[model samples]
Target: MNHNEIGIEALNQGEIEKAAEAFTKAIEESPKDPVPYINFANLLSSINEYERALNFFQKAIELDDTAAAAYYGAGNVYTLKEDFMKAKDFFEKALKTGMENSDLFYMLGHTLMKLEQPKLAMPYLQRAIELNEDDNEARFQFGMCLANEHLLQEAVNIFTEVVKRDPQHADAFYNLGVAYAYLENKDEALEMLGKAVEVQPDHLLALHAQKLIQEAK
Candidate 1:
């Protein structure tokens, strides 16, 4: 089989080192093969070598300017760097290249939230949920984002859905309690917070939330 094809095989097997080696060989054989560069960048990212991964992604894009994986890699690098604005830009570029990825939209939403542009983030976050209704993390994060923006009722709704989906998700119950308190629904807050403590007694944030409620009364 061709070197690129071999690399793809190694990639699917999760033999990261082998895949990288094979992809490197493929690149040496075809210096303009953006596929190998993109695949290699993904491996580098899994290893937490963000800077080097960015270089590989750039190489992929240099060979094929419209490469979506290249921009996606750059976006991930920016995410690791906590440079949310740059991450947002690269993710948008990746989307422009027709990469209709739910995770990409979720990342974009998160980045916008980090930038304190929740208005822009909401639609993307919602779209991510639409794409994958079972994404509890996305739903939870979107709820917190909305709560931070004073959309307490909506945030409560989302967090409630999270707990319903996974009752063992203590954080969801805890955060839902917090949102309930914000809405002055003290009884519901206490009920959910008590459930959170039952699920994870050592949850420090939930403990703090309880303390605040006690102090409030």
Candidate 2:
């Protein structure tokens, strides 16, 4: 069988490296096929080889102007590099090409946050949370974004949801303590900060919160 067919079979079998090898051979066999390039880009990104992944993403885009994933993948790489503006631009391009992953919304939130446009990030972050409430990372970020925007009450809600979803997440607990402190609920702040310390013994922020509370006493 041709390498392209082998690649498809291997990918179907969840043998990613074998699939990548097969696609590499397919790229050699049919240099014009964008599929091999896309496959290569996906695999490289999975392995965190951003530079090589970006090269293949560009190749896929060159071969297929209509490929949304090419732009999305590139956006992801730029996001990893902290190039929020570039990432946002690429994400927008991908959306124009019909990308609709909730992750795209999450990325938009991230990009906007880095741009210090926390208010602008809210809608996208809210959309992401609505799409995937179980996405604790997005929820945590959303809470932080809200807190930064002076929407302390809303921030409290988001962080509360995060702690509810994963009680073991001490950072969320720590941040929740901060949110409560902002609200001037000293008792709740102390309690949550204590919970954070209980969950993560070495949590500096929790310890600091405890110290601050003690100093206030």
| lDDT against the true structure, each candidate | 0.87, 0.87
> Candidates' TM-scores?
0.91, 0.87
Tens-digit lDDT track of model 1 for 108-176: 898998898888888888889999998887888788788888998988889889988999989889988
lDDT of 1: 0.87
Regions of candidate 1 where Cα sits further than 4 Å from its true position = 12-14
Q: Kindly list the per-residue Cα lDDT of model 2 for residues 20-138, writing each as its tens digit.
A: 98998989988988878887887777768999989999999999988988898889889887888999999889879887868988998889899999888888888888888778888
For model 2, give the 10-residue run with minimal summed lDDT.
38-47
